[model samples]
Target: MPHKNLKQTGFDEMNLSPDVFAVLQTVGYEIPTPIQTLTIPRMIECKDLLGQARTGTGKTAAFALPLLSRINLENKRPQVLVVTPTRELAIQVAQSFNDYGAKMKGLNVLAVYGGQSYSVQLNQLKRGAHVIVGTPGRLMDHMRRKTLCLADLTGLVLDEADEMLQMGFIDDVEWILSQIPQPTQIALFSATMPAPIQKIAGKYLKNPEKVIIRQESDVTNTIHQKFLMVKNINKSDALVRILEASFHDGVIVFTRTRNDTMTLTKILEEKGFKTEALNGEIAQAARERTVNRLKNGSIDILVATDVAARGLDVDRISHVINYDMPSKIDPYIHRIGRTGRAGRTGEAILFVQPKEKWMLKQIEKATLRKIEEIALPSNREINEKRMDDFKNKIYQTIGTEDLCVFTDLVESTAKEQDISISQVAAALAKMLQGNTPFLPETMAHKSAAKKKGTKAEIKAKSPVAPKQKQTPARLTPNKIAPTEKGMERYRIEVGHKHGLKPGDVVGAISNESGLESKFIGAINIDYDYSLVDLPFGMPKNIFNLLKMTWVKSQKMSISKYAC
Candidate 1:
């Protein structure tokens, strides 16, 4: 049985900031899809969100938009932090923040990973990024440098969190989360929720709000989808232009979920366009009839959910618009494949925000095709396209024989109203609109109004002072002196207040400081610094390397324990 899939519908009702809302409208986003509807409010209220949604259900925006809303542009340190499994995902998540936040002034996002240079990571942290999106390992590196501090953190998001745990990054994540203030709001989004992950959530998150988007809402491979990379803000304005330029017989806007679908549908309808809703909650019989109507040309656009729109055997689906970008690489392949089938090159259009550039890159990576980033169609361009389309509709309507009576009526009305035939055509345009205007008011370009750049340029933050290389002296029992080898005793800055046992000190220093696990002869955690034994009488070079390493939360400089 198909679950009642919800479509993303409207924004006027939500509590999102105007700057964020303006970005959404330009990108053609409607109401909150199910995840957005449920998650957006909670995200704004600073509550922990435990969301259960599949790959393509609009989960990214649900979190990104709200999380970004909390970021203080003036606050220097990382206020919003997201931990993902891999470098690619970390990079993608960072892009999402930039896309939704294109209108938010002074918002900078950086992606951190192991392969990236440490000096580079230090630079970005120092450059005053408002949000930090990174893999656990690199983020841990920042914590050690004290370049990226969490004391002022407002939100901590763990995206695709289960995958991080499965990949042996849970320990790193837990350690990082612990360093953050206990009052931080945490949001965890994963496709499959495992017990271990839930346990971690239970242990860390404050009373969380949980919501799951059904699977059918995800893009189906049987259908085709394609997205465009545009160099501007206000993807929604671009979408309107594209719709006018292209010939789509019937369109179902696949948003992240119900709220998005409804929101988009209402906005389109308000634009005096003929649009209707189709989703999982609608009966199957109604769903089939809707598709049939589209096939027979009774309806030109049916905004529906992926679940409800499935099994739609309509070959006339000339276009599939991805109003919201897909998160994973696979769905993109599936959505674009919906068109250009049966020997026809069907069109697929995606409205990408400034942040969605990475998502576009991933789609290209998956499909092995380079999607061109086109310029936003101007209002003049859209008007011309609409005129061309209207002319085509007229030619097609004239080719059919069923308009005899309507034509006579138009002729008589023209004569009675004492208007020229051209004026009558204009009058019909006004009449068809009736109470609703056919040509919706042209929305202004939003990304242009934004103070932030249309594209986010990746830049290095600041250099963390590399841990000073210690000159190893001779071994002094209680004191740390530079010797031939590294320091005989590893120096620690934390003590009992850190709740660390001797084994904890031993394990952390050994693992991070890179000294042999067995060679850590003695660990004495006193009032301030701890002394850990190591191989002595080596070289000064290795000792210098050890100085750059870090233990649990402290950097192990090769020095004597300071009382």
Candidate 2:
């Protein structure tokens, strides 16, 4: 976010404490992001602020540095509370606080969120934390149980308020805001200011200083975005082909549901990948371990849901594969933003179904870039890549490791078998390959299609399924059809009155029913209920489960809606 033309320079100009400045210097944060440059000073002065900044624009550090600078490490009774939309962001913000305040003694920052152990949070609360970071639900739960004492809380941050609004946490956030003491300094950061967000700012934030940052379009310039058209059933095969053929330092494969993350992780592992799964359900310690593994080269691939991968920043991740496309454009941006960090080039590949092409267009329009259509990696390509990798592996081993014993064995074996040394070496390589062949068979069909031309090949390999019986479209008196081709509308019992948002319904249905986001269609919210379009042939078991799935403490009570 740093502007090259801006005259203002380092954190020193902001008159930050030496302790905070030293910690920043140690972390190599020489230049301030635009949000940080503007918001830090106001936060330090204990003034209410409203900052409009994107997630990756260093907003966390903007608020964290100033808050830590003014933190009373002696008292340690929840002096600052930061509420985020998701557990991943909460953990990230808490980590930022700890990293920046490392020089300060007796600094205890606690991150509490749903799916985490309440007993652990209670224990942490009893020990008295100087700062608390958590999601709205978990924070409200703790506050309701009288475990989180906010009487001494001096500073508060509502980070990503728009996300909270979109996730249907606005009511809970407002309740939390109403409970905070009148004198508490508040700072709210949101990427966009919708009417609801603006209303909240006017109501809860008093005389707030405003900092608006324009959205940067150049973030994705270094990332090559491409889309592969594939059937839902063929995604795994395509993914395997892509992984085998594409060169990447590290890859994050994005899936819609947590279960998909686990399922995909196992599949990749079975195929001999150093892979791990990250989701909301993963324990905090385990999540941190998985992320650290990805960071330290212990794991070369990560399969994660949108919520789990929210605050992820791994510079070594050279590729982001959207195994299942997101329903929203914002999430698509956030997912790809994980890569191309530190000015390194990256790639984002999306798997698109026939029905999801409209959403792809929406994403293209939102990002102001055309996502080039790319064919799935052919078997011949995979084989070539495998051969190259095998040769490289042998070369690296010869250069780095001692092969004297193996060389002698190969030589002796060749002499004993009356065979050439080359044959013996080839046999050893075959033995090393074992069940996994180094060079897989090339696709004869693909080669034939290619001979006919690129367009012909695409048509031949098109993901459209063979003609099958279609479900009769059900019509009511209103005579409305589902917005998309293969989706059917259904009613959910929670809506605007319950502070429902389209994302909440999508997330709930996907999480509870294991339906991928791309399968979800248009969502319309009403007063006390919402209508959503889902894939027409949802399994009965999933339907039954979703009928009782809870969102906002209310049962979904899903039923077919003719609208």
Candidate 3:
């Protein structure tokens, strides 16, 4: 096992506030991740800085903690401002600031972004915010409205700088930066250091300290990656079976939209597992509560979208399940990156439809990592783990706990019934075996048979054998049947009249459904609406679900193409 990075130090570790240290200790954060160790000191000193790190390396806290320490909590005006490319990310970073600053007295943090009621945001600013985290569009809106004043801003941070550049928000970001008071501190963090970002930093930052944390060359090595090639129909049953078989403790299940995050969480709860949902629509207070539940022992599973999960850290997380794989590579890393933290090995399980394999390739290429596939856990594995847990519990009870009271009661019952010691013990074991499934022998073969091929010499396990034309029994419930194997069409209302574009439709669908944008076929936007070809036989429930989905705040519905 590698040494944990959260506590590993770089500069003056002693400079961290006692409150910050208290929170870290209570949460079991031990070492400083490379970025945290290197960047915290500079940030604490209120120095201009640049940090380059991958998605999962604790960058949020590195900037958040020190910024909290540097700010004047006594001031009601926004003292520190952090700009992210998306509303989800802005919310996430603001929450992080809240988490780390909870121990600090009088600190106020607010997240401002579009897609939410403006009055509520205005009210928050009216109430006063010391730390403001917001997206560019919304920030510009606030600046233009003169509701937010930046002349007294003490610190500014641009997170995921490269993503801002990609989304064509660089000019806005630069303009925002240009308007900040000259004496303010500046910090930027990005996975990739694109030229445009560098130019912005070169022009704005003064004698900035730069820290680039090394990404694991062997991301695939530390992570156990595998995908099941089930069709859309049978996925729910398959997931239940897989969860039972793996016995994962703390799990994160990814879905595409806020509704689906709740949907999956409800499903998992019905299956008898404690679960929670995190999404853009969820209240910020509720989001923090759910994440806290997942971090503590109160909840075992969290179902969330990519945006809802930004800067999320839960050290006990044992598994990251891609109920729906992400289209973007960096976010994929970010999702799976939840587990396998602090040098502890973790598992990543992906569920892929036959059409989504290309996305797998794209993800592999993006991370410069080759993920090995493995067979889904078999029924036998599930039963075996159950038995193991039962046996371990029994052993632990005998080893450490006082059994005198129970033992005396058992003795009295045995005496009253005239039963022997062995029989009594056997009867006790039987009664204790409540809901656990008995390990069945043939169950192991069920999982093994699903594999394509297993190599004896291979170090990383290969993915389960790709589904072969496979039967309908393997399909997931929400997946619709193919209209045509390669292409299909559905109607929408936003075509030429609405000035709809291909990317707009794709983004809307992908954001709403877990399906990758690439899976969407030809899109022809009409005047009022448009028609799009998607995988055939869209699952009735999902189709019904998507019918109410909206793009540009317009209902996205489908019918047989009119034109």
Candidate 4:
């Protein structure tokens, strides 16, 4: 039977190294997610394993923590290779590896993907990297040119295997796997087990340990989930606008870190909202007091971290605001579950940065619901609400109390100043408004137009759009004329007969010189050598580096070539 319902109270039970555990603590993760609990031990044992979980399930840490602990820092050659389906994921996984292994000095981790300067990657590889994270196509390019040597590779991981198959990269993935040495540990993770992915696993893996994570909770049907596209710098302002416009009885704002709770609570309190901070740093008695305040209407807003807010139930909580998106999807489910309880409707508002659309997508996929995108509350809406509230207070005072004294004072002031009663009332209202603007500048106009740009422009500028693939031009040695501007043609010692392709030469030069591929000019294969154009004014150090670089068992022996 597949591993299910494995109980793990904390990460300590996983036996991870102190350094790795320390990183986890700093990241605010005390307990392991289900996938982490099931996968970490088997990976640490160097067993071939399969983990089936949707995105944002802490899969990166599940594999990364164990692999980081086993890294042999003394040997800098690539020991572990991770294959991702997208450059974004490649970068994210690479960063995670770097973060988790931060305590391990001399741990060299590189992320290789298309659209990045090849020169930088090549230089890093030449210097020696212990771990490499990359997308399939770029990894293949590096492997074919032997820039990414896997002879020392001790383990291999295929993250989001199903995505690779869907993106038509399974063949390249397979070719990459074929290059790994025998008896090397392998792990494959995917959300679903389709036939093709299963075939690759069956062929490549040896009695793999399998763990499948099912959805932990169904997002409450009564909770209407929505997201706002806001920048990090503008989130606090946008959050305030949301509070001012929306009608919420009690709100619980979720932040990622303990310090964030304190910071946001201070900001809200300064805004004159009855707000309190609840985090692990607070004492139990203080926390109880804070909760009691929320219960008795002394505090209507509570800023908290996930751990601190666990097991907290307040029926008055009509809204849940994700001030910081949770690192994992499971926490998101729990965070929103704080509201919409007992068959009552609740609202969950997520503040999403542009780079975090991937996480947003993961939340939607896991929840099986579409989170509607909403614009921030407009200026007119906020001002109107404030004015309505101000008017309602005056009307309530007039209806409930004998206002004879206040009315006589207003009449006396108006008669003495020889002004209309309306003028006197307006003066009092302005004084009551104090420094706060009665009609604040429109919010969405300034934030939306200035910070994010127009919607059409934002969509056009979205990084989610796939980058255009560049196909190398086929060239003969004779056609190497009219070198592109600011580019100098150079000749190398290896060509087609050496089993060299255009990609190999480009990868080799780009890797050696740390020059971006876009700056690298044309390439033409001669009988026994190849000619390629590189950026003008090549540095002596880079030239020397290129001369020593190898491709297809041949030294580059690079020298400037005239057309």
> Which candidate should be chosen as best, given TM-score against the real structure?
2
Tell me the TM-score of model 1: 0.42
Name the better of 2 and 3 by lDDT: 2
How does residue 400 of candidate 4 score in lDDT? Answer: 98
Model 1 lDDT, full chain set: 0.67
Better of 2 and 3 by TM-score: 2
Expressed as tens digits, the lDDT of each residue in 454-531 for candidate 2 is 886777888988899999653222233447887788988887766677788877777666678987888877778778
Positional deviation of 361 in candidate 4, in angstroms? Answer: 18
Global lDDT of each candidate: 0.67, 0.83, 0.77, 0.82
* Estimated TM-score for each candidate: 0.42, 0.72, 0.64, 0.47
> Looking at model 4, how many pairs of residues clash?
4
Misplaced by over 4 Å in model 2 are: 1-5, 231-233, 280-288, 398-421, 442-563
Better of 2 and 4 by lDDT: 2
Candidate 2, which ten residues in sequence have the lowest lDDT sum?
A: 473-482
Q: After superposition, how far is residue 524 of candidate 1 from its true place, in Å?
A: 61
C-alpha RMSD values across all candidates: 27.7, 14.3, 14.4, 20.9
lDDT tens readout by residue for model 3, 119-150: 88999999999999998998998998999988
